[model samples]
Target: MALTVPRLLAARAEAEPAHIAISQGADTLDLAAWQARTQAIAAGLRAAGIRPGERVGLLYGPRDWIAYACSYTGVLAAGAVAVPMSVRSAPAELAYMLEHCDARALVYGPAAKPPDVPVELCWGPERISALPEAEPIPGPRPGDAAQILYTSGTTGRPKGVVAAHANLTHGARLNPPLRALAHSRHFLHAFPIGTNAAQTMLFNALTAHAGMLATARFVPEHFARLIERHAVGTVFVVPAMAIELLRSGALERHDVSSVALFGSTAAALPPTVAAELAAAMPHATLVNYYTSTEAAPTQTSMVFHPARPAALGRAAAGGTLRVCDEAGRPCPAGVVGEVWMRGAGIPRSYLDDPETTRHVFRGGWTRMGDVGYLDAAGYLFLVDREGDVIKSGADKVSTIAVEAALHEHPEIVQAAVLGLPDPVLGMTPVAVLVATRELRLAEVRAFLAARLAGHEQPSRIVHVDELPRNAGGKVVKHRLRELFDAAPDPRT
Candidate 1:
C-alpha cells in the first residue's frame, strides 16, 4: 500500500521500469529513469542538510516539468515539507513567502531570483538530470507534513496550506477504468509549478493510463500544435485557457479531433465559453471541476450539463460536501450559504496560522469560504465568494452577477467587478473589462441598464488589454484594483 506519492511512484518504477512516464516536446523519460532521478535529488537534498520537518522552498519555472516533479518528490523523500512558490511572483512576494514559512533552503530553477535565504541551490534545467545519483532515504510517515502550497492571499498575505502525506497521496489513489482519462494514451495540460492543478495532472499521470504531456507555458497556438502533433486524447485546462483556445480560432485551424475529453478547473466556466467548447469539441465530454488549494483533488466534478452549465457537479467518490448557513447548519435545497467540504485530500491547516486554521478547519471539514447552494438533485451551485460581494446604497450585489452580465456581451472578453468608494452610496460597483475594442463607461452603463438593477450596475468602467492571472488561471483581483482603478473612468 502506498502511504505517499513518492512511494507509489517508486512502486510504479518497479512494476513498469521501462514504460514512458513523461513527455514534453522531444524530451521523454521512462519510469525507472524518472524514479532514479527523483531518488537522486532526494539523496542530494539530504546531503545538502535538508532536515526532516523543515520547510524547503521550491522555485521551478515553467520550462521543465521534470525538475518540478523530481525536486518535489525529493523533498518528501527527505521528509522535509516542500514550500513551492510561484516563479511568476515578485521578489518581495517570494521573500515574504520564504520568510513566513521559515524555509531553511531554497531549491530554485535557474530563472528564479530567490530571496536572501540561509541556503540556496540553483538547479538549472540542464543540471536537473545530471545530479549525482544516490540511494533512497526513508519514506515519509502518513501524518507528516509533505508540502506547503500558498493561496492567492486575497484577504491578506498568501497563506500556506499544509498537506499531510495522506492528503498529498489522495489524487493518485485513483480507481482504474476512468471514463475520460483511462482511454487516452496521453493527457495534456499547461498548468505551471506551485499550483495544485499542475500537481493533480502529475498525479493523473501516475495513476491513470496516460503519459503526462505538458507545455512550459500556456500559449494557445502552441497548445493546439501539441494536440495535433501528439494526437492527445485528453486535455485539461483552466476556463481562461479554454476561452482563449476558442477565441484564437485554433480549434478550427488545428486538426485536434484526437482530443476526447476537455476538462476545466480553477474557476467555473462561463456559459458562453462552455457552450462554445461543447460545439467546438462535439466528440469530447466537457468536465468542470471545483475545488480549492485547501481542499484539492477531492473535488466536485460536473460533466457539462447542457441545462445546468454553471452548476459545479456533485462530490467525487470519497468526498463529502454540504451547503451551510452562518450557524454551520446545512441549508435546504435552493438556499444560498457557505460551501463546506471534507476529503482525504483536504489539508490539515494553514501553516503557522492557528487562528485561520481554527476559523476554517472544523472537525474534519474545511469551510470553502464561497457562497453557494445545493440544487434539488444534490448538485452544487456556487454564487459568489463571501468576500467578493459588493455593497451599494441599499443592496448587496454579487460580483459574479455583474461579471456574468458582462460575459453576455460579445465585445467583452473578461470582466472583474469590485466595490469602490462612493460619496452618495457609501460603496458603489465598478467594472474592469478586458475587451476586444475600447469601451466607454456610457456604453457599459447602457448595456447593463436593462440587465442589472440601477444599484447593481457598474458606476465606473475601466478597460484593460488583459486581466492579470496567477499560474492557476484565477484573476489576481487585488492587482486589477491597483492597476485599473487609476485608469481614466469615462464616467468622470
Candidate 2:
C-alpha cells in the first residue's frame, strides 16, 4: 500500500482508538475524533468543487490545532495537495505564494483574512460541524505530489519545493531515528506547522501514535506549563526560543522533568546556549539536527557526549551524504566542501523553476548549498552556507565558525557573522552579537583571538540587544548585510 497521511491516521484510529492524538490546552481529541474531523472537512471541500490534484492553501495560526490538521488532512483526503503558509508571513508574501501556486481554494481559520483567492473556506469547530461527513477519497499515487514547501530564500526569491508521497513518507520514517522520536513520546509543537520541521513532527506523531500538543503561539511560560501538564517527552525549538527561555528564567520555575529530549534546528545552536540549556534541563537529552526545506532531516547528534559540542551527527537512515569540492569530487575528511545528499528521501525538485531545480537537484543527489566536512568517524560538521562563506584577505572563513567562537564568551548570548563588501579584500568579515550581560569590543576580540585564527576573526564587532531573525530562528543575514553596509566603514 502506498504510504499516505490518511492511511496512517486510519491505522492509528483502528489500533489506538482511545489514544489521545492531539491536545489543545484544555481540549483534547482522540485518534477517532481526529480522523472523523479530517474526513468531515475533506467531504466539505469535495462538495465545494475541490478536485483531485488541485492545490489548496491552509492559512491558520499555530494554535487552531485540530482545524489546521483537519484542513491539511482534508485537502489530502480529497485527493488535493496542501500548501501550508506561515501565519507570520506578511500579506505580500502570502499573495506571492498564492499566485505562484495557483491555489484553487484556501481553507483559513476564523482569525485569518487572506486578501483574494478563488475560494475561501472559513474553518472552526462550528464551521467544521456544519459540514457534512464524508469518506476519504483515495487519489494520491505513490509518485503523486504530497506537499509544496517554500524554501527560506536566504539569498533570493523563495522557490516552491515539491515532495512526492513516497519521498515524504520515506523521509518521515527516517526522521524519528534522527531526532530519536519514540512511540511513547509526547511532542510539544510550538513552531509554525507550515515549515518542514512541523511536517515531520505531525507525521511522526500520527505514525508512532505519539500524543501531540500545540500552542497558538510560542509563550515561554505557557510552554513550561504544557510540558508539566502533558508530560511532554520531546520538543523541537529554535535557537531564539531557547535563548528567550534562558533569559526569561521560565524554564527554572516550571516542573519540566517530563521532557526527556530537546531538539534544535533551523539555525545553528551555539555551544554556550546549549550548555546553558543543558544546565537548565539537566535531566533532558539535548540534540541538534541540521537540514533545509529542500531536504529533510540530514544530520543529528545526541547531547552529553565528548563529541557533542564538536560536530553534527552522520547522515540519517536511507540517506547518504558527501562533502564535495567545486568539481563535485569528494573532499578528504576535515576539509570543508559543499554538502551533497542522495537518497530515496530527498525531494525531486522545485515546483516550477526547472532551471533551478536542475541546478540544485542533480541525478538524484541534492546539493544543500551548505559547506561542511565529515570526520574520519563519518560525523558531519557544518561550517556555513557556501554563499555566506566570508572571503577576508586570502582566507575563506566560515561565518558559523566565527559565530561559534563569539558565542563562547560568557557575556555573549547569540552572535551572527557575515561578509561585507570590501574594495581591497573583496569582502571583509563583520560580526553582530546579542548579549545577556554587558559586553565590550575588546572582550569579544580577545575571546575570538584565543579561539580562532587571525584571518578568521571579524574585523568589526557590533553589539546589539538582539539579532534580526526570521520565523525559523535563522539570523536574517540579508537584513544584517543591509544594516552592516549602511554603517560607516571602520577603516575610513
Candidate 3:
C-alpha cells in the first residue's frame, strides 16, 4: 500500500497507466501521464535549489487545476511541504500566505497572476516541464508535514492549517485500502484549488477508482452541463452551488439522471434545500458532509432523510464527536455546546499562531467552533456557529434555525440571518435574502410566526440579488452586516 502521495502516484501509474485520473474540459491526464508530470516537476524543483522540507507556494487559477495538482504531488515527491494558494486571492493575501510559510520557491500556472513575493525561485509550468526527468530524493515520511491549507478567514485573516501526510491519506496505507467514493467511475466537483474541499477532491483522484472532473470555475449552467456531458456518476457541491442549481433551473434544462451519488460539503446543507435537491435528482443519493479545515478527513456525513433533516450525521471515518461546555466538559445529549472532532489521523494546527493552535487543537481534538448538539442516537445537529448566535434581549436565537425557516417559504431561494444592533434588544435578528419576487415583510413574518419564536424571527428583511460569499462558497456574514448598516432602521 502507498503510505505517501509520491508512493500513491507510483502505485496508480503502475496499476492503471492508461486510466484517466483527472479531467478539466478537453484536458485529461491519465495515471501514467500524471506521474510523469509530477516526476518532471519534482526533478525541476530539486534542480532549482529547493531543499527537502522547504515550503513551496503553488499559485494557480481554478482552470489550472491540472497544473496545481501536479505541483502539489511533485512538491511532496521532492520531500517539501506544498502550500496551495489561489490566484483569485488579492496580491496582499497571497503574499501573506507565502511569507507566513517562509516559502522557498513558487510554482505558478500560465493564467495564475502571482503577487510580488520575495521567494528564492519562481517557475511556471513550461519551465518545470522542460526539466529532464530524474528520481527525486526519498525522505518524506507518513508523519511529515505535507501541506498547509489556509482557512476561509470569513471572520478574520486566513490562518494556515498544516496537515501531515498521514492526515491527508487517511487510510490509504491500510490493507484492502479505504478509498473515497470507490463505487463510482467518475465524480465531479467545482471547489476552487486552494480550499480543503478541493484538496479532498485531489486526494480522491489519486486514490479512488473514479476519474475526477472539475470546471474552469463554477457556473450553474456549466456545472449542470458537465454532469450531463460526462455522465458524471458522483457529484460534489457546496450548499451555495446547490442553491444556485435549484434557483437557476439548470438541472431542469440538462439530463443529469446519471448522477448516482450527490455530495454536499464545506457547510451544512439547509434541510429545505436538501429536500428540493432530492426532488430534482431523484436518482441520486444525497449526502451532506460536515467538517472544518482544522478537523479535516474526520467529518460527519448524513444522508438526507425527511424525518431527521437537521442531523449532520454521526462521527465518520472512525472519528469521535463531542459537544462540550465552556470548560471543555462534554455536554449531555440534546444540549447545545461547542463541537469538537478527533480522528485517527494526526491533529492539525495553525501555521504561525501558537495561541490559536493551543485554543483550537487541544489534546488531539480540533475545536470545530460550531455550536451543536448530539441526540440520544448519536446523530449531530448544529444550531449555529458559536459567534453567530444572536443574543437578543435575554434570549439567544440560532441564525441557522431562522434561515432554515426562511428557506421553507417558496418565494425565498437563499437567506442569511445575522444580528444588527437594536437599542432596546441588544441585537436583533435580520434576514437578508434572494427572493424570486418582491415579498412583503408582513407575509414573511406571518409565515415565520408558526415556525419561530418572537426573538428568533427577523426584526427586518433586506432583499438582495445574491449573498456575499468567499471562494469556498461560505456565506460571509460580516459582509451581510454592512447591508443592514446602509439601510434605514425599520420597525419590527
Candidate 4:
C-alpha cells in the first residue's frame, strides 16, 4: 500500500483495537472506532461527489479532536486532498484559503458555524460516531497530494504548502522514535489544528502507538490539568504555550511529574524560558526543533544540553542543514548566514505558485528565510526573520497583517509595527502610528481584538506626527523602534 499513515492506522486497529487512540477532556476513542469512523466519513465524502485529487477543507476546534482526526484521514482515504484551516482564522482569511486551494468541500466542528462554502458538512459533536462504517478505500500513492497547509507568508497572505503522502508521514515513521516518546503510554499536546505542529501531533496519534490527548484552547492551567489527570508522559507545546505556563505559575499548582518528555517548536526556545522549563519539568527531557513550512518534515533532532539550553539540535535523522552567506557559499562555524535545509521527505513547492515556490525551493533544498549560524558541532542558531515577521513570544505575528488590520480603521492613516524585547515572551509587538484621530493603545487593541488574535494585537501603541519612511516609501522599522524607545507615550 502507498499509504504511510492509513496503513499504520489500519495496523493499529487490527492489532490493538481497544487501545485508546485519542482523548480530549472526558471523551476518548479507540483505534478500531476511529478507523471505522474514518472509513465511513471517507465514504460520505465520496458519496457527496468529492472525487480523487479534489481538495477538501477541514476547520475543526481542538475539543472536537476526534472529528478532526477522522476528517483528516477520511479525505486521504478517499484519495482526495486535505486542506486544513484554523478555526480562529478571520473570515477573509478563510475565504482566501478556500478559494486559493479551490476546496470542494468544508467540514466544521459543532461549536463553530460553517463558513460560506458551496458543499459543507458539520462533523459536529458525536456526529462521526453515528456514520455507518464503510469499507476503507484504496489510499493514495507516494506522489499524491496528501495535504495543503496554508501558512502566513512575508506578504501577509496565506500560502498553501503542498505535501506528498510520504512527506506527510516521513518525520513520524523515522526509525528509532525519540526514546521518551516511544516509551510513553499517552502523549498530550495543545496545538491548534491547521498548523504544522498539529500535523506532527496527528502523526504521533496515528503511529506513536500512544493515546494522543489534546485541549480545545491552550490555557496554561487547562494543559496542566490534562497532564495531571491523564498522567501524560509526553507533551508538546509551542513557545507561547511554554511562556504562559511559566508566567501563569500553573506548573507549580498541578502534579505534572508524570510528564517525562516536554517538547517545543514553531519558534525558538528562549534560554531564559528554557532554564525555567528545565526547573519546571526537572524529570522530563526538554527538546526543540527548527523547521519552516517549506523546509519541514526534515528538522533538527531532539536536543537537551543544560549548558546551552537554547541550542536547536543537529539535523534530524536523514536531514541536512547548511548555513550559507549571501553568495550561497557555506559559512564557517559561528558565521551568520541564511539557513538552508534538505529533509529526505520534504516537499518541493507551494500549490500553484511556481514563482514563489521556485524562489524558496531550489536544488532539493528549502531556503529558510531566517538568519542563523551553525556551531562547530552543527547546531543551528537563529537571529531573526529577514523581514517584519514578528516572532512575538510563540506567535508568528505578521507586522503587515497587524498593520492591515489597523488600516481597516479609517482613523489610522499609516502604521509601522515592530517587535520589542520582552522577558516573559521572547518578543512583544509594538505599533507606532500616524493617525487622523486621537487613538490610544486601548483603542488600538480594542479595534484589533476582533480582527486579529490576542497575541497579534499590539501590547503597546505610540502616536507620532509621521512615521519615518525611506525614499522608497517603506516605513523604516528600526527608526520607528527608536521613536517608540525615545518616547514612553506620544500624544499627537
Per-candidate Cα RMSD to the true structure, in Å, reads 2.3, 2.9, 1.6, 10.0
| Model 3 quality (TM-score) | 0.97
lDDT for each residue of candidate 4 in 161-268, tens digit (9 for 90 to 100): 998887876744333345226668899887777777888788877777577888877788988988888788888887656766876779999999998888887767
| Candidate 2 residue-wise lDDT, 383-490, digit = tens | 888889988778888888888788677666678889887888988888887787666556777877879898787777776777876556577788887776566666
| Predicted model with the maximum lDDT | 3
Candidate 1, residue 35: Cα displacement in angstroms equals 0.8
The runs of at least 3 residues in candidate 3 whose Cα sits more than 4 Å from the true structure, single-residue gaps closed, are: 174-179
Q: Show where candidate 1 strays beyond 4 Å.
A: 120-130, 171-180, 483-492
lDDT score at residue 40, model 3, on the 0-100 scale: 79
lDDT score, candidate 3, position 91: 91
CA-lDDT, candidates in order: 0.82, 0.76, 0.88, 0.77
- Which model is ahead, 1 or 4, in terms of lDDT? 1
TM-score of 1: 0.94
Poorly placed runs, candidate 4 (over 4 Å): 119-130, 153-155, 171-180, 388-492
Rank the candidate models, highest lDDT first: 3, 1, 4, 2
Local accuracy of candidate 1 as per-residue lDDT tens digits, 362-383:
8878899899889999999888
What's the distance in Å from true for residue 210, model 1? 1.1
